[model samples]
Target: MTARNQGGCDGEHVCRIVDRAGEHFPGSRGKGLTARTQEVLDDLGVVDEVLHFGFRHLPHRRYLDGDQVAEADPHAQRTPTPDRPYDGGLLIPQWRIERILRTRLAEHGVRVELAAGLAEFSQSANGVHAVLDTGERVAARYMVGCDGGRSTVRKALGVRFEGETKEQAMLLGDVELSGLEPDAWYQWTVRGRGFLALCPFRHERSWQLQAVPFSDLGAEGSFPEPSLPYFRRIVDDLAGGNGIRLSKASWLSTYRVNVRMADRFRVGRVLLAGDAAHVHPPAGGLGMNTGIQDAYNLGWKLAMVCSGARQSLLDSYQEERLPVAAWTLGVSAEGLPRVAERFVNGGSTDIADGAPSDGQQLELGYPASSLSVGGDAESGPRAGDRAPDAPCVDSSGTLRRLFDAFRGPHFTLLGFGESCAGPLRDVGTAQRGLVKPVWVGAPGSGADLVDVEGHARTAYGVTGDTLVLVRPDGYLALRAPGASRTAVRDYLDRVGVSRSA
Candidate 1:
């Protein structure tokens, strides 16, 4: 989804996206939305719309051989805090998520060209020439492949797709069915009957069905088309029908446990992102979220390069994101078998038994990247960690979040003492659109932002004045002593943020 259509880049750089698919398919995939994704949506200004339609907590109501057996949650739910307004994975169908994001992109004048996928592309020192599947040759400054695990761009680049696909597979679909409670996730694990679960979608009569039959269903890339009759038969055999009737289906697809990643994220001027770069097992819902993060991480950097930043800044995309993808592959791989074992042989509700509690990837960062530097505190977030959000008070007695200060397509510099005001102001004035500076001090100490409750200090682990520079994507790029505006200016120079040119 990263800048794949006309004017797709985050800012004004002309961008375009081509979806291989003919249209948006209504599929209920990726049941959990982590807080990190929420933060990205927040940064994009679509978090409120996503929250309006998504849910956080729902108990999985389990059954055995046509009898209601138990009810338990899939994972632990956390309450929203000031520092982490989005607490846990949200339950929004992948289709709705796409629509929300698509709408937001459209708001920015992005034009998504559907059914026009990349057939082949060639790049030179300056730009790329892309031949779409539609036989249209388009020229662009750069090219990014966000297609999927079976990415044409990846294949064209001859990049090796590394990893294995498990024999385990599942049937996924959204069907309009009646005769069951629409609120709970109904699961049936019948001996020899196979495992089946029906989860209701929000504000829609259709429920998403996840089923695993005992038979292998002719594995190895061969499977029957997802049909309503096949689903009804499964419901009859495995679920004992339960009087639930499927009127029709909106979307249907089969999922295999594939854990794979590209050997390289970029080749020449053509770049790979999302599933094109990596694909994960269904175990932790890491597939979609990891891809989204890849796009988010690349978006700002790509925009910068497009806007004349150092070309080396583009190198950091893979340098930083490839490791995250590798880590995600490992995590998803470790959790998949446990999840499959439980789904096939039901026991506990924590199907993701060994998955990281940081499911939302809030703790995710690029600590080792060239972009991260200068945080020496042992207890607080170091460079490359997400800049913690804190609620601070303004002079008007208004409450403002650190996120509020961090929003928009700009670097943010926060100085936590009075002494930093002068230099911070100077930088803000010089790099007005690139970096926004906010000074925090006691109410009467005359700072741009006032921290009366010490929330900022608590969240950031600051005992005294400190200077923190956050990148456009909200990761702490640099954290140093408050007086070292020189370090700030140096980093700006390194990243090539032109001073209001």
Candidate 2:
């Protein structure tokens, strides 16, 4: 991976590899013993490192238009249910997130080469050959371009980036403020002029400032260089002597909003992911989250194919992700105007209210992918939907969550109700290493799990015998009513994993 930034989805990929290896290579632990290496690996065992600084719930959003308050939505104050631990989105700085991921990658003996980049590459029928900027030659079965919007790999593949750049540019910067609460979001909009927003960064004494100047202030159809003085003027104009003052400045930039995506995610053996694949406004905070998800979706599929799954499986990356990117683009675009309108007219701000659920990203799924197969259309989560998490009791009488069972790289076969027992056991025996089977029955029935309070059954939409095969990325691959072993077997075979017996 030729990553310009060593965090975000790149870090996530490294963590996923470590998790998978732990499950599959349990016996190989400490075989090649090195004291230092073991220590690093031990540190990487912190499974929650990915969400180390994440918020328990979304932060409250407050909207202000000049001195007048327009709306305040404390959506993040909602209590989290057992099934849904994260009630809203998390707010963590990108740099810090990258640091945590880098630490994990180091444990796995993967070091990111800073200042190094992909110089050139070519692909044949079998694999891809790449030359790094250091003149190092490397051959691999595949190459992924997670290299931001100005991806060299995507350009080399001649993929068209289809989208338009907004005529108006916005000024963004990080600075210290003399007066402002660090708990809520603040914004000011002058009707038909422009808008200014200041949100508290997670870091102390720092804030993210965004300004869109009114057309009359020479902001429309042109770009302006960002400077400390320029930012101060905008803050003064927007705040109108509200005791808010910019004390010190750190980083600044001028950005033109561009919403575009590659015409194709894959061109032969090279694939596009993250900003290389799509770029849109950060209206719904979708940028980083979407990219991380794109990596998660592609990682397991790539692993499967490299281990003898069909090459055709790679095609589904585009099929499943392209539409999602397009839809996300539309959502963010639609939200921009709504937010601007709220700043201008002082009506109820849909952007603030909708963000809790809209930005949670729990609704994203791959229902139309070739890998998703058979389930009742009218009831329950479809084959392509996200597998909902639920609380349950393990066979050992310990409490566990569905997410715990789905943590590893292998497929999860969930058999709900008593009727599913025989087929579930048979499928478990047949699939062995590739599938981990869990029989969910009533409490005290001696199943692998006892669905106490019927949480699992309710969350899974299973009233009777049902078998759900969840993919490595926590999406349903197949849902067979009546616990049909044939359906499970056929779906597995189609995905290039055969039954052992």
Candidate 3:
């Protein structure tokens, strides 16, 4: 549901989301939201609602040469951790997520103007000037292009989209059909023809179809048009027409494998995000997830800058995310071949079959960024690592998790011992609601947060009087070994986190 829309503004319709499509329709076949992505939704306060509409994982039932059903679980071996609550991905339709996000936005008086598109935009010292497809004008402080691949914003920035388009092409659509059981995802791969997969939508009554026809529609090697009639013929040809009827297409799209990324993510006041920043093979279900990550990382930084933080904070967006985009390109490049091989050898369930262990993305860290600072500590999470979670008790003997402390739009100053109390109070007072300091120790030892089962200490690898400063996005910005307030304060000052040392 990530669009080629304009985002980032407020009040008097100053910032608007301009979508080129006239209506809200599910557009892509990507529906996997990984564990790391769930963390982002948790911070935004919508993970429970999303979970209500999604399933743990769907089994892939493959049909080889029109017979013999083979069933496999893509996420069978994964398990949840004290630190990583979500193990794999949740399978829900794209439209459901879009609706949830839109509803959340509307609660804050944010309006999404449908049937409107970003015709063009220009950046000036004062701000940004934009013209919509409806011939309306908009003025804003900054602009972010959350648009998809083939984005108008990326093109306008003259950012070189460096990569190659694959020789293989595909037909993807959502439709109404009968004679197919919705119990498991159905896949078919004949001798030389490519594979076909039908995944039932968890929320909707329809199913998503992705396949390669290889039938002659015209020219030398051109693919067939994504029409209901053509899909019917192909399905019939492959299944021998076992009374499986196809009709009324709700959505249809042609997918050409494109692995590309922008040379740079920003230019002046205008910046690029999501598919506008990177596009990859649908393998690993990384296209939509990567775009969502882009938005999550940019959202807070943009908010801070708008509230008058230093401009350099926005520059870190490019520094930290560009490397991740490069990593995504590599994973997708290797994954497509595994999926392609499945058509011949029956190795995969869907396009997402080839993703490696790290696809959960829970371990993704920004160790090299300028924002990550301090310590030559031998063990524990280093600066820029994702903050781990552990179950614990509050001073009132109430059960809580480390995530409960880090949930909102504020920093968490976790002191491993009572000796760090002075720095904690000072930081809490200085940053006000921006920083919350929580002490971890035994009850009545003057520790507000008790490590009930020693899970917090073990998870953090804490063996001493240490202090870790977690960013609003849940990554550690500073991890000082000696509970030094000076260390914490100096690091915050450098990152433009308000409050001088």
Candidate 4:
């Protein structure tokens, strides 16, 4: 793979890349990943890698304004239980996440070629041809621009990036700190001044520092360059005394808050994702998570299309993701001013407090996409909703989660209750490798596996005869009542899945 910047998490220009190893940062400004995103990472087989790197299960978030302090609700820390694996969220460092992704890609025999910038590119009916800054030419059937907000690919495509950049800028960096507990995140605000926050990093004596200047300070001709002295001065002004000391600094940069999105995610065969597609403030910590989901939403469709599926499958990428990007932009933009106002007034700046439940991205779906079909309009998880996970027993009597059955890159046919068994079997037989059928029911009900406590049934909101066809990306493609193998096959056929396969 050709990358415009250096390889690994240290790529400066890339939004996903992190410069430090063994350094910890808030996964999402302390809100963490929703159980849904965690499930997706687990499906990709990288969740374990992140855990192996030692993750901090933050118990509480503390906000400090001068002498006043407020603790977040203890219930806010609740995550999904084991039985409902898709329900909770996690907190892990971006660096560790980057390492896990890089490791996984390497295991697949893919290598990143760093500093190979895309200078120019064009596409024809056959494929896209790209020219690198090194005078190299490469061709591919599709291209995705994951570059940051100032993307050359998006610029070259002439996709209008719509939104505005705030007049104020925020400063972020990793620095060495003293006399602070690493267990809880710390935020300090000064009335009519500004705000400063320090969250524990992965390594000892390290913290991720974030500071937003007051309007008066920000309005000054130009922002000062980020340096040790400048950071120390700000810290002294905002978080002085209390035995806090900012000894040294590593990475530092000034960023203007922007809420912009590409008018079109795709121009011909070239597509955009991440900051290249949308840019927004970091209030809800939605930037990185949104980008990751964008790739996840597009990856399987891209694979199917490249493997001879209908070109229309690629169209769903933008259809499904663009709306999501727009929603996220709106959420972050709405939350930005609140957060900024809180900072200036020395009030609660907890982003989670201002963020909506959908900010976790669990509720996001492609309900109106062309790929979704056949489901009850008013009951249960209809087509295009995320497939929830519940506990189940496998054929070997081994206890497993519904996610275990939906783990791989194949469609899953879930037969809820005994009445749909024959149709599920028939669909499984006809689809074979293209789909995996699992019979869900009470234990000893002669089904493939028992829903046992009926968690699966309850979670799926299924009773009597119901069949849910889950797409490879873990979204409901079809949810039909009664036994109808035709319905299953028709839905598969619509998505270009061969029944005979």
Candidate 5:
């Protein structure tokens, strides 16, 4: 099926598409958290228009104390034009996504559109149809449900989303704080008034603040926040004697904690992806990143399946991403109670104390199921490792880098000196559908990078004419001290990327 990029009232519905279009890719290195996120998206080539069909009529607002927050253009806050590295939202800016998607997707040959409601969907042979919300029903052999926590498609299929909603309700508000430095994240915890965290806001000279709980009002208080005094009190206590002031209240709402995961991610022609399959608390900022990873894992697999590259390639998606998602849910579950405990006791965790591990981004290895080589052997930084990106030099005797070749979809083979070039090149091209080799350093450069007296060799271990084959996902598939055709073939067979395509 042709990819449709347009939908959502204005062009704003495509923010996710634009947010990741060129953000994540090989060779595109970035500094700071937000830029890193963009590079991740760019490397993955998630260049498509994202559709924002989440419950719209559900009371959305962007408030500014007395600043008149403007109309619901939908296209306003679509793309994340990140200005700094440490801008403090757990993930990308929590608001104005669709607007960015509109602009980003257009460049990738996709359009954004907004539709009112779901009119129909595709069902199965037991009286099922292959269609969706729009009246135009197109039948496809496969369907993946990415709909959200309350998934309509999952329910229709009789799949259960099991989990409990937390009894503790929070009065959440996003506000701007004045008289505070724009350079850092400020947080203050109050005894009975709830907690407040202040951080930078994108675009304008405003800051974003959140006041949790706001009040001790029971869940029966009907909707939290008509109780402005309670919220103000929390803000007041958090400010302490510092005389801090807050204004430009943005969104004020209530959220009940929830954690859930689908019993199964796939059933026949339909599959589950992102929140449609699992939902968890907003701790650690894993929610959105997890969903984006889900998209990444599935996108390439789907492309392969649709392109007829391999049939078994499709099943690996669930095998690879499901367990990772499950582990993420587990980690998130562990974090929720710890957060509450910290709030209740006024005790600081390692995070609150500014520990080194606080902001270290998570990088997960592809699961054993996703391993393409050395299945039973030792794990990590071995054959079948995501070839790390580092600086290096070319055969021209000039300093370049390793990531330059790792960017797009090309077979990457690495070797040390001129002696191994003929063998490496011969072995790489010996097979028509597999393997491509590239030499690093120059002829007679005194063996591999180990002898070069630089960071490049130390980074990639080019010591003594090592030969390494890297996979498309940046992992190393094989490493040999010398050129070995048998070793290369064995590594290829182990990873299912054999010469016998």
Candidate 6:
């Protein structure tokens, strides 16, 4: 392919595509964007290039139009969702994102060079240098360390990862089983000795199982790899050797739990994300999700900073994400021990509280920083509110997600129907660069039209007609039930946005 300027309606800077296309590129998974997020990227003009590779091809069909596309294909089944219950372990979205990334990154002009391991990394005031296993050195303006708990970059930076490793070990394996309860996750315990959890993956033929042995029960004081016999023994302990039978096994691995967080996410131009910065026991299946969110949060900020945002804007990344990671690590640390205790003390089978905790749920707000909009005066979870997606209507009389129009780098103002918030709509859109107003509800609904379901209403805590300004990272900036342009302007200026408009 040739270098080309793919201009947009806005102008030449909208997007550009210039790179090699086809087979030369290699694709690596385990961390990539999903189809839904990819569509968002396309809409934002963040990626404007395509290069397909061998054994990597688009599915040629959309999966989200209420269709079960994955059920029809063997390969597609590898990506599973909560909608489909499995007798085995569930295939979380993080894994699905990985599958898509393996294909999409190459399509988006990322040259994936694999099989070559990293040997060393060196950093200077100029930039960071990575020496690959093949003796190739790659240099970049900045290097992000997304490489799991044992980060090579973090080591190269001479930073020590602070945390304790657990002696309790878990044996995990994916197996094919039948005659088991279908469509739900299963957990059973042997009354203070061991506990077993079974989750279904994508295919009916496979499932992931985790078995935790009680103290000093194993030969080496660690849960070792389980053969067919050993697995059956644990199954019998949990299920009394009935109700489920297993035959085939896929992948088996052993993991030692650890809870740790790095001192600083940023060391000069090199930064850390995901497990590299914080590692926690996998109680809520959040290790991967948190890591992915870290990448997503950092991805756009890095892009904006590199493209020309205030340098202070870049510093806010650590300020914003570190708290979230800290909260996640704390919650996980609190949860796993409780879970272990419950299993040991007769397997109570009580569910962990799924309701969002103050620290667990909110889109951590940054105070005393360039990105913060609201002042530190507010109490409760107001300072750090996760931006809520609502059912809303567009100007053309079509229903749309509140998050849809609010995409890209801008503050989104959701004008809840016209009655109560009609005045807010006018005030919000009039603010220009600082605010982008979007009207929700039908054409003639009163300014305070509230059509959200119970779940959304409960999540957002919306009482009546309101104006909710969502920040770029999907956090509530300023919220008011009534319209007030003066209030909006004051908040924007506080956040460092110019108020010339």
On lDDT, the stronger of 1 and 6 is: 1
Better of 3 and 6 by lDDT: 3
lDDT of 2 by residue, 1-501 (tens): 532212233224322111101112111000111111111222234335534543333343434555565444454365556555544444555554556657766776776665456788888897777777767777667788888788888999999999988654567777788777776667676566667777664544667787877753354456467788888888887776678889877778776678899999999888899899999876776776677678778877876666557788889999999998998788877776666656567664634542324466666788878889984545668888878778888888898888777776689999987778777887788877678988888877998888888878787777668888888888889888755758888887887765432
Alpha-carbon RMSD of each model: 2.4, 8.4, 3.0, 5.2, 10.3, 10.2
TM-scores of the candidates in the order shown: 0.94, 0.85, 0.92, 0.89, 0.70, 0.69
In model 1, residue pairs whose N, Cα or C atoms come closer than 3 Å (at least 3 residues apart or on different chains), thus clashing, are: 4-16, 4-17, 5-16, 5-17, 6-15, 6-16, 7-15, 8-15
Per-candidate clashes, comma-separated: 8, 1, 2, 4, 52, 12
What lDDT, from 0 to 1, does candidate 5 have?
0.50
Candidate 3 residue spans exceeding 4 A from truth:
1-15, 216-221, 241-243, 345-350, 444-446
Q: For candidate 1, lDDT tens digit of each residue in 1-501?
A: 223223433355668888888987668787667889889889888899888777667777888767777887654457778688887777788888888888887888886778987777777787888887899888787788888888888898999999888877889998999788877788788765578888886777778898887764784744578899999888888777579888899888898878888989988778898889998877677777887888888888777777767777888989999999998989888887776666556654444454666667998898998899885675578889998888888878798888989888889998988768776987887887788999988778877788888788778877777888989899999888887758788888876665632
Top candidate by TM-score: 1
Query: lDDT per residue, candidate 4, 1-501, as tens digits?
Result: 222221222112221121211343333232256666777888898877655543335544544656646765433655665344544445555655765787887776554455566778888876677777668777667778877789888999999999988776778787887877776667777787677777775444567788875643546324678898888888887777767888877667777778899999888777898888999877667777887888888777766565556777788889899998888888888887787776666666664555656656777898899889975545567899888888778767898888888887788999887778787878777877668998887877877777878888777777668888898889999888757767887776776756442
CA lDDT, every model vs. true structure? 0.80, 0.68, 0.78, 0.72, 0.50, 0.54
Q: 2 or 5, which is superior by TM-score?
A: 2
Residue 39, model 4: lDDT of 71
Candidate 2 least-lDDT 10 residues: 25-34
Residues 338-363 of candidate 3: C-alpha lDDT, one tens digit per residue:
77876656543465566855887877
Candidate 6 wrong stretches, greater than 4 Å: 1-94, 101-107, 202-204, 215-221, 351-370, 376-383, 413-469, 478-501
Predicted candidate 5 versus true structure: per-residue lDDT over 1-501, tens digit per residue = 122122331223222211112222211001112222333444544322111211111111222221223223222232332111112222224343334544555776565334422334554532224433345555454566666777766886788888877765555555566676554445555555555655553343444455564455575433445334555666666665656676656555666667888888767656778788888765555666666667655664544344334445667677777776777677766776677666655544312222112222334546365545533233225653345555555554565445555555445677755656665767667744345666666436543332234444455555576667665555565666555556666655544445454
Full ranking by TM-score: 1, 3, 4, 2, 5, 6
Clashing pairs in 2: 193-214
